[model samples]
Target: MAFACQRDSYAREFSTVVASCSPAEVKTDVNGKKGILKGFHVVLKDTLLFPEGGGQPDDRGFLNDIPVLQVTRQGPDAVHFVQMPLNLDSEVHVTLDWGRRFDHMQQHSGQHLITAIADLMFGFKTTSWELGRQRSTIELDTPEVIPEQVEAIEQTVNEKIRQHIPVIVRVVSVDDPEVEKVRSRGLPDDHAGPVRIIDIEGIDANMCCGTHVSNLSHLQVIKILGTEKGKKNKTNLLFLAGNRVLKYVERSYTVEKALTSLLKNGPDEHVEAVEKMQKSVKLLQKTNLNLLRDLAVLTAQNFKSRADRGPLFSLHRKDGDNEFMNIVTSEIGTEETLIFLTVGDEKTSGLFLLAGPSELVEKLGPRVAELLEGKGAGKRGRFQGKANRMSRRPEVEVLLREALAGWQPTEE
Candidate 1:
């Protein structure tokens, strides 16, 4: 028994013959929801599973109670993917996943209604549409959609949906005169034989090959989320229909409640409270930096002299950064001084700086970095970079001190 599901989309259950069943593996990420999964490919003589097309996803259901992972179309074949292959020439019972199918139908039908309104009222034709897992979008030819126009579209679409209009689906010959009366951009270049048109009460009758419910009222409601700038001069209108709208509302309410509790403010005051906290955080950061700068200079000035070490200067401290090192170097007055500063805490790496006369700095800077098992670069006066070995801080100080202890600077 090979039932033509496309001829009667509302048929949830049907009988079909497994024309050919082949064990083939399909590797897919399932749209980032998971890693690659493997499945088998089985083609049916006739199937109710709409093999993913017209911007709608593949129908998921069962063939003889075994899960049908997905359905796809190849040329004139409806191919079903499953975990286990069915027997060739078997009479299988096909059942569509009612909820998933209904959701796709509602959103796909809503798109047609919305597209018709956009084209009829604003002369902005729909170039494309996508039925995403959580939301749907229609790309319009216009560069932008004004706020008023969007509100108008929502109002009109919902009104028609509330009218409980019977959705009329009819197939006609390719050269039928009725196709000319239908508001279609045109049939596809490769379209052959008959044309399928979905007529919405008095609003629209457009060419579509996707499954839809029997009536517009099944859409329940249509909510336009917003508009986004799309390719070149196009605008993508995001929307939700039926249960998707309900899910979006539920998620938004949950987030809003969390923010209200965390901010200790009502919904109306969330923006003001967050802005005030941000300003206070910025002010505190500024104040703390100024204090650290002063302490770095004081710490540098307190270091004592070194005998026969040729003006060697070294300082090691906790919580020190590049800015702290720069401040200390600036405080130590000129004197052909060879300065080294290594700073870190107990559990992490630190940074090192070597500064002195051009000849000594060039000779000793890279050597100090190497002694600490790190890399650095400098030529004229100062060399600075991070060192991954914090325990090697003392080794860095000793290497520079001993190197300078034997150094003699060239004439300026």
Candidate 2:
């Protein structure tokens, strides 16, 4: 289920893939040990067996012409599974996919840069990290970073990249005197042998098992994508580096170009243009509302010609806005007159209803709803519905009258 990229002494030969296998084609091994026979090939998983799960991705490489598809830990054993069939006991040439390996290196190194910069510039330490696709994150020792401070940190990291500092990798015994010189806070307790330390010259010296470039300059660039508040006293800083940084820069340029054209402004004026358009849109919205109100008054005057002076009445209007419905309903609804309006789209109808002092809603609303195969409910004076396929307003009017035949006024 996982691949382990072991940062072992054997890792010096970066091109070889190591794996473990048995001579016999056995499906299950109870002892968790495959029977050893002559000429069996072995592939090594990149992960440590005992440490188990971590955020690190597994190593993928080729073992003696067989592709080491994945690396996993089975009990105490780190198993490297191969993809191709191979002869038992044949000598194999192992090679890791260096592109993937280097990618992890860049990300891990970028994390060091960000975390170190946070501590140096802002007095914040990184508590954890999440390596992700397109971007990675470092959880800071503190809860929040202000915009100006974040910008400063970004500036600092980029400055370091430009410095192209030497990155030194040292394998030292846990009890070695040099271990005390390392500034990285935590070392895995389970590590029994020599520990690996990555030193970023004057910037950082941290304990790490992940592979890294010989120099910080290989990282090319470090970019801060964004940051968000995490759990108590923690903040997550998202970032990218190397090829990812290049891609991000390219994408940002493309977006800037599109925005410039849309706003009809040069790059320097685009931001101002966007703000101006936003203000214009708000003004247009207010003007539209005033126009709707005036139109509603005219619509109500036109509907007055159809009033029957009956206790319950209905009206229909084609292609009217919501304001027209509001004006008519508010004007005609009273103690004796119930009102209904149907607004139809191309394929369906919208019904707006208001009952008077009587419980005309209970009588007429359900009948109209059932006839149209719709659903609606209301209190003493209001109801609404969407009739899915009902097109004719006269049909709804007939159903409403029949349902309200015995309706009578009642006090609230």
Candidate 3:
């Protein structure tokens, strides 16, 4: 038997007796976190809530004011999951979320119209379809759908909608000869009762279990967004129907307005303006890199000119990169003085390099990295790595000074 929801898609309320209610646990994800949800699975003698099946998500509604989290089809029964349980055989008021159900109807019916038109006009068979939150897609048997074909299909579908073609629902026996005339992928393994066929006037008849609009005009309009490459020599066509298209347009216009204000250019000129800004940024980056290189060399020279300096010397530059640190080390000659160079913020994270005597560098490099909350490796009198605590640079200097105080340059 067809559920009450399948019989009347327009109905929002139904009074049904609870057949059974059992404790149940469901797994769900909220805001990206997965957890187990404790609930009760309640079955009604008849319900207006559609179960999750046939590519359409389950309907969300209320059973006597308690929120229905999910509904699933178990064989011929519609199982409603809720937080509280109801007494068996008790009469309960069921309320369907009209907004959600209506939106789903528009998209599902739009897919049917598009599928029928594509097959009739271009011989493109719909292999599969998905009604998503914001948009819907239909996978065609062909490898590709050209722009012209999409336009034609979209135009024909909208025309049919404007014509207000009747969408009739017919329930036929499983062994009925009329079932052979309708398009079907066969029945589900646990499917029982008669089969329901959705007939679109003289256009097409398809066997489906999902709820759909009663009239083609209810679809309002359908916009074919575009097509994408699909697996196994197929094409996935994206589309928006009814209020979805309107919402998409509203969001798009809001974004365009915000960009216009920030870019100081109209929507038509925004792309060109962004391209020019990108070029200017690249040029500035190149100029900044050249300046840093020169600054590194000057910094090395300044350090070398310090006659009264000790065996350990340290320097920090917030704008410096790996190349800058390396250039400074190369110019300073780490043979006599142990060079400690860092590039980045002093209070935050950055890179550090310790270069000097091979043995001292190998021993002290690890300690310096530990103090700065980092890891590094070294060989041939050079150790370099990233550090997360550049604020501890002074602590690292003290450790290096104490180690160098008892040290003397070995005669080579």
The backbone clash count of each candidate, in order, is 0, 20, 0
Question: 1-412 in candidate 2: lDDT tens per residue?
Answer: 2223444412423342344455423243447876532233243434322122234565676665555545544443455655455544445555666666677778888888888888988899888887786789889988788889889998888888888898877777879887887766565454455777788999998877666677778888887878898988799888898988888889989999999888888989987888898999999987877876776676556656665555455666555555666676676655556677665563476655545554666656777676666777777666666666556556767766665576545545
* TM-scores of the models, in the order given: 0.76, 0.64, 0.85
Winner by TM-score: 3
lDDT of 1 by residue, 187-211 (tens): 6564555788888878889877788
Report lDDT (Cα) of residue 220, candidate 2: 88
Q: Candidate 2, which segments miss by more than 4 Å at Cα?
A: 1-104, 143-152, 168-196, 209-211, 225-236, 307-327, 334-377, 384-412
Q: Write the per-residue lDDT of candidate 3 for residues 1-412, one digit (tens) a residue.
A: 8999999999999898999999999999999999999989999999999998888888999999999999999999999999998999999999999999999999998998999999999999998999898899999999989999999999999999999999999999999999998887778999999999999999999999999999999999999999999999999999999999899999999999999999998899999999999999999999999999999999889988988877777999888999998999999888887999998988889999999989899889999999999989999999999999999999999999999988876777
What local distance difference test score does each model get?
0.83, 0.67, 0.93
On lDDT, the leading prediction is 3
Ranking by TM-score: 3, 1, 2
Q: List candidate 1 segments past 4 Å from native.
A: 1-5, 8-10, 23-27, 30-38, 185-193, 291-412
lDDT of 1: 0.83
TM-score of 2: 0.64
Candidate 3 positional error at 65, Å: 2.1
